[model samples]
Target: MTSQKLNTFLENNLQELKDNGLYNEIDTIQGPNGSEITINGKKLINMSSNNYLGFANDDRLKVKANEATDTYGVGAGAVRTINGTQSIHDELEAKIAEFKHTEAAVAFQSGFNCNMGAISAVMNKNDAILSDELNHASIIDGCRLSGAKVIRVKHQDMDDLRAKAKEAVESGQYEKIMYITDGVFSMDGDVAKLPEIVEIAEEFDLITYVDDAHGSGVMGKGAGTVKHFGLQDKIDFQMGTLSKAVGVVGGYVAGTQNLIDWLKVRARPFLFSTSLTPGAAAACIEAIDIMSSSTEEHERLWENGRYLKAGLKDLGFNIGDSETPITPCIIGEEKLTQRFSKRLTEEGVYAKSIVFPTVPRGTGRVRNMPSAAHTKDQLDIVLETYKKIGKELDVIS
Candidate 1:
């Protein structure tokens, strides 16, 4: 029997969420998540996965992973501070630093943990973090963990960031100030004004941090957003994930050798958790190698994105201003957005609806992530389905 107090809390909160149309109903995918996926035995054109380059299902990655498992076994065996630091792990970290053009790099169990560990490791109550309002949830939690005064600057507003930086610096209330932002804003698919951000960082002598989770292998010809702007040396922290475009499961912070060394000892996740599997580490290295060697996947991704975006726009859907391939079909009402997503699924498309408080109330949308593996015909089918649904729902005239 469950405790009344605990049960009541769960039941009431969940009920409230459902009542407000904020409850998320998860769909079970039967097989690998790629350009196409099966849900409840129904195959759909997948537009909701972060497999930007389709590396997750690539045969090359599978071979590398299989080879690593055969050579090193499945798990890392222990926490990184113990016996988990395999040679492949070291090799992966070296490649991360090389790919990002940093002096050193350190890997973590996940991107969320990377932010949580890296932020708290360096920042403290003696510091202040000037974060963009649209920064990821992990970044928000990481700031809270740091015990620092977090000042939220307006999203992509350089003037506001500059003003906040000036005020934070002149206040003299903190010993150190850091400016952190997402290299690519996930929801709106817009890019952070990194050049302006770096200039402001220089003027304020602020530590620069960028979480390029969405930008890796998608921007800078697969290098990242920092490399996109050629401001890598100006930024202090470059955090990214191996799970997204890299097609593996891990995260890394690339910076100076001292920063990597400090994180190795100071980052709680690194010290407390087992390192990435040998297979994942090996696959990550090969993925980077593939990206560096050829631009086929990168070019294919952008082509698909442009094709999808152009088609959506031609159909009179509001895709917003996306600098990346992430497309959002903005629907004004939460319930309507959910219904639209349902309709899309019914029509053999698998785009997910995002509503408040994920994207602010009344600005709900069906977020579409087009991957490189999607054929033009598959995308056209998606487009045709979307058009029918939009017309049926009166979302477009």
Candidate 2:
């Protein structure tokens, strides 16, 4: 029983969102979220998942998840600080450290929670964070939660970053400063200027943090964006998600042993929340092993990305300047973008429209995430659908 006023407030806001074409309709997939998904009994080519490596439905990961479940049940039973730190959890952390080329690592229940925990754990009111303007929502929320003075530098503009870092540091108002950016911008599929970021970080003695959620298993031969730039050792915090390219459920921060130790003790989520289930932990470890052992899936992902991008570009869609497979067909108006996405879905493609609040105004786009699991034929179908919808909607000739 909530208050009538609270209910009224929620109803009014929801109605406003619907009227403004900003309310998102959540779709449920009938089976595993793979290259193709079934929604309302209609199968569509899935170009919206973060299953970059196709590990979500991989047989090897399934076997590992089942095996771990048999050995350790479904739940962790308690928070990590209490009794949830099972051997598998520890093993996962060790493998994460190995995979990321860090001295140590710690895991959290989710990517957002990990960022929230990690950012707030080390940064505080006395510190200032020089963040990229295009960093993830999780990163933005984490900074807000950290109570730190946040200065957003223009996205991947190293010169702006340096200026902000210098200003923040010389101001003498903050005890420490951190420069944080995403390893890959998920929305545009553009990579962070890590090399330049690192140079600026060194010049200003700024602690470098990279949230490589979209970079892992897709860049650096499956190591990640920091590793792609060969700056793993220099980054103070290298955070990533097991749910994205790894195709499981969790997140981790790979860093120095001292930093990890501090996070384990201080990160509120790790301290207060139950750990990832044994199945998720084991599946994630196997994912890392797979990523480390082979490059087939990673290569296929990039190949699919290139193919989709090339086809979409050849079809005359305004695909943004993306270095990776996350293709965004920039449809300028919100309602038009939503209509475009709906037409796409009706035509058997499952790409979704991203509008203002998620992206800036007048930059609405239908984002496509090409994964390793998507076949040539499947992609061909997608391309055909896009062309059909593009012409019908007058997005292209």
Candidate 3:
């Protein structure tokens, strides 16, 4: 039977969240997630997906996925350590390594698991991790799970990172030290200062890891943020996801052959969880090939981002300091932020509100993710709706 205490705890917390406008109401996308989406049978401009290159529903990827599915069954039979490692999985890893300019790579079931497994695999109670204060939730949890002493470095503050790194090393309490940060901060859309970060890492002999989940397929002509800074050889662990720009589902870490080999045997998620399905592996391979060969999608994505950002800025909306395509329309109050997003949906755009926990309280925003699939006409409509909603809601005057 359900525990009575559990029921009471859930009831109280759920009500409190709703009352405070902290509760997120998930919208059901009735069709393929693309430049436009359908929710509750109504069509809306889709600006809130990680499908950066518009490859999520691309025919080429779908074709490859189908072929792989026909050749191999739906799921890998077991974990990679056992008999689950399929041929396509090997091909996918190789493709990832080549694309990321690394000697080798290892795949994970998801981006979250990739961080969880990779961090704990090499770090432990004897180590300390210096992480960006605004790093993704997965990175924070990974640091915690490693049982390491986690030091928070101020967001994009290289001076703070250097100080903390020196302190951690000089403390002499930890056996090893590592620095982890997101290649692209998804919220503000600012990128990590990789050149300075690498210099600091070298000075302190610290292992460096970059989780480029948003950067891949969107930066360095589709290679990622590390390559954007020409630091592929400098970073130790180059972690990324196939689910975002790759338009598939999986995560990977590309580095030296030895690093990947260690993760293959040591990362518990790889050892215990089932490998990615053959279809997904094949689709990921296709996506990497597309990224390596063409800049069409990548260029288009940037264009769309610029168009949207200019529109919002011209309309006097506070779109934070975004270096990438991710644009956020900052709305202060929680209820007002949620209301803004709702009004946007009613007016035909699908931008969603990001509140506290996702972002800091009082910094609530309507995060817009512009993809390559979006056309000028669609974006124009989105801007018009935004202008109307902005003035009406007093989010902008």
CA lDDT of each prediction against the hidden true structure: 0.94, 0.93, 0.95
Candidate 2 positional error at 334, Å? 0.5
lDDT digits (tens) for residues 1-397 of candidate 2? 8799999999999999888888899999999999999999999999999999899999999999999999999999999998999999999999999999999999999999989999999999999998899989999999999999999899888778888888888889999899888998988989998888788888889998999999988899999998998988889999999999999999999999999999999999999999999999999999999989999999999999999999999999999899988899999899899999999899889999999889998999999999999999999999999999999989999
Kindly indicate the candidate among 2 and 3 with the higher lDDT.
3
Candidate 2 clash pair list? none
lDDT (10s digit) by residue, model 3, range 1-397: 9999999999999999999999999888987999999999999999999999999999999999999999998988999989999999999999999999999999999999999999999999999999999999999999999999999999999999999999888889999999999999999999999999999999999999999999999999999999999999999999999999999899999999999999998999999999999999999999999989989999999999999999989999999899999999999899999999999999899999999989999999999999999999999999999999999998889
Worst 10 residues of 1 by lDDT: 15-24
Which ranges of candidate 2 are over 4 A from the true structure? Answer: none
Backbone collision tally, model 2: 0
Clashes of each: 0, 0, 0
TM-score of 2: 0.99
Model 1 clash pairs are none
Better of 2 and 3 by TM-score: 3
Per residue, candidate 1 scores C-alpha lDDT tens digits across 83-190 of 899999989999999999999999999999999999999999999999999899999999999999999999899999999999999999999999999999899999
